[model samples]
Target: MKPATAAKKLGIYLPAAPQDFQDSEVTRAEFNQLQQNPPEWLAELRRNGPHPRPVVAQKLGISISGLARGGVTEPLTTADITTLLAEPPKWLVAERSTHAAVRKQDLIAKKLHSESPKN
Candidate 1:
């Protein structure tokens, strides 16, 4: 098999497909929350202030103990959520990965079509 055919057989592609920005939009509230509010692990690293967990619990009208036990790590404060809305982070590499996966599927389909004999 030629290099291209061999590579295709191995599910590899050169010059990967362009990333899709629209599909990469951050719609998950929890993920957005975690990115906006510094995680407890990160806050401790920066030493900027205490973990915002207590403050978030108070704002949400939930007991800190309840929030913690509920495993709701990285709960977002109102301001954090607002800021996230104002300016969200770009998941460039993630989008690229998704695009590549979709393109690979398309390539595989094309290869299969070419291989199949038609009546």
Candidate 2:
């Protein structure tokens, strides 16, 4: 797989990865190995992340759009994420509630749709 594909699957920011990982193609076996038992570099990246947008959103408990609304446009390191978690700003609180409400609504919609008669 291409580096971008591998990075996406790993939930990492591609540009933040090491040059070798960025330069190489990852075979299926290698991809699996990386997933199952990441090397130190990979582990470090995940552990002290300049995480990808989706990852940042998940850690912040906000939707992607909510991130934009909160001016969190850039990727954040694990420390930065932790700080946000520890002392959530008003926007963060609001966004979390909004995210939870949206998820609840989505679940209800899916349940209702699943229970409806098929055409």
Candidate 3:
């Protein structure tokens, strides 16, 4: 499979697989290293889950759809997903705060309306 296709499976982007490396080849040193200490980046991705997709995409100033389309499927390392789970954009933070404020205001308005005499 093409590198991009592989990456999409894992929600990552790989411009091209190393030409000199055989796709099926795996060295003991690399395998041992992975077994001993998996990349922290991958661990974070697994922990965060899919909620970060939109956040990271927005922060990176890239369209969510673009990220989705560019996602890889195979060898879906945790690192790839971690990138998507990275910090959210400031716009989202502001939006969430605004939403909370509006909710609070609505609750207060409702309480006041109910307390007041209705003509």
Candidate 4:
């Protein structure tokens, strides 16, 4: 699979991946192996992403604008994310409701789309 696809499956940011990983294709077996038993590098990347804004926002259960409002201007490691979850600040608590609403809307939209008549 393509590196980006592999990265998504592993829940790691592609840009944060090592040069070798970026330059190579991940075979199906390798993908399975990574899923079954991640290497140190893969584990590290998943835990500490130089993730893009969208990924970070999604992980934090906030919109990009919310992140900006909260003064978050950088990629976060899994540890950082965990810390926030463990001791959620006011901004995060507020954004969690927004995120839940957004997810609910997305589910509603998906259900509607699937129920629509086929072309």
The estimated TM-scores of all candidates read 0.25, 0.93, 0.30, 0.62
lDDT of 2 by residue, 52-84 (tens): 999999988889999999998888999999999
Q: What is the lDDT of every predicted structure here?
A: 0.44, 0.95, 0.47, 0.84
Cα lDDT tens digits for candidate 1, 11-101: 2221221133112433356334634684554344223222255554444444555455545566454565345436533432333345567
Pitting candidate 1 against candidate 4, the one with the higher lDDT is 4
Note the residue pairs that clash in candidate 1: none
The Cα error of candidate 4 at residue 29, in Å, is: 1.9
Model 4, 9-75: lDDT tens digits are 7777777888999999999999999999999988777667666567778888889888888888877
Q: How far off is model 3, as Cα RMSD?
A: 12.5
Prediction-by-prediction clash tally: 0, 0, 11, 0
Error of 4 at 94 (Å): 2.5
Q: Which candidate is the best by TM-score?
A: 2
Q: Once model 1 is optimally superposed onto the true structure by TM-score, how far is the C-alpha of residue 8 displaced, in angstroms?
A: 32
Question: Which candidate wins on lDDT?
Answer: 2
Better of 2 and 3 by TM-score: 2
User: Distance (Å) between predicted and true CA of 68, model 3?
Assistant: 18
Better of 3 and 4 by TM-score: 4
TM-score of candidate 4 relative to the true fold: 0.62
